[model samples]
Target: MTSRFTELSVDCHDPERLAAFWCEVFDFKVIDRSEDSVEIGSWVPTVEEVRARQMPTTLVFVQVPEGKAVKNRLHLDVSPIDASTEDEVIRLLGLGATRTDVGQGPDRSWVVMADPEGNEFCVVRSLASQD
Candidate 1:
């Protein structure tokens, strides 16, 4: 079988702060934490579940000495489950996210935003609002 996309590791200056911000962004729970890292997802899975690839993808924030210096080559694209894109963007802003420009011009459907740690991501229109 092919490998599963299980976890995304992010290097940051403060794991706890980034973890907290992301958890609020996605309503994720902190499944695990260590001295230099924090893992957040929808739930805490057992080793068996993880090995079987039955767990949802999780984000792991690790402490690093260097700060983010350039635009992200890879980023996450998210849609709100129960809100309009504008509302979701407003909510994310309230949670400490700031709008960012990565050459995404005014006509694009997705809005670019940066997390507290300066990682760029997108908020796209929800399916519920499209029809």
Candidate 2:
């Protein structure tokens, strides 16, 4: 059998804040919440048993050490799910992502941006445009 990605958890100082930020970024919803964490998902899992047994698929933002350096070895590369690249960039910026310069020039392509926790991500041009 082949392995598949069930979730993408991010370590942050504030889980709720990060979760909220990602929720807006991906248009995901808070399907579950606790004192220390929240679970945001694109699909709505039915039944409590199903939700619990379904691998807890979510982008969990857990609390971490303070003064953590802004160096993420693994970051997400998000593309517009249903909107244009420009629109997606605007939405992400409004959701708290800041434009960052990772030495990539205009010729290199992709809009480089950082999350609230200083994690760098790229927003490339729409896939539809390539086709």
Candidate 3:
């Protein structure tokens, strides 16, 4: 059987804080939450309706006791939906994200950044800018 990509589960020390941070970063809302986990997603008409339509994936943050000790082997790369990457990067920086260096050379096409919890993700050039 074939499988479709769905949720991305992240292990963090603070689920609530990380979930909130990701929600702000993606313009998503917390759809489900528990004592040790939070799931955030873009709003759709209804859960069943959205599921039937195969909505986009959501991010689930789970609380863990330990902090990040190394670089993420699988990290996210985000591009602007309506604005330039520069503007988005500036806004993200204002939201507590910090620029990070992960051995990517200066000539890289994307800018690597770390979240409040030191999870590394990239901000790539916007589609409009590439066009």
Q: Write the per-residue lDDT of candidate 1 for residues 31-90, one digit (tens) a residue.
A: 999999999999776767777765689999999999999999999999998889999999
- Model 1 stretches with alpha carbons more than 4 Å out: 51-54, 129-131
Error in Å for residue 6 of model 3? 1.8
Could you tally the backbone clashes for each prediction?
Answer: 0, 0, 0
Off by over 4 Å in 3: 44-54, 128-131
Global local distance difference test of model 2: 0.78
TM-score-based ranking: 1, 3, 2
Residue lDDT tens for model 3, 15-127: 89988898999999998999999999996336566556666888999998898999999999998887788888999998889999999989987899999999999999886
Worst 10 residues of 3 by lDDT: 43-52
Q: Could you tell me which residue pairs clash in candidate 1?
A: none
- In order, candidate lDDTs are 0.92, 0.78, 0.88
- Please say which candidate is ahead in TM-score: 2 or 3: 3
The TM-score of candidate 1 is: 0.91
Regions of candidate 2 where Cα sits further than 4 Å from its true position:
1-3, 44-57, 128-131
Model 1: how far is 103 from its true place, Å?
0.5
Shift in Å, residue 16, candidate 1:
0.6
TM-score of each: 0.91, 0.77, 0.88
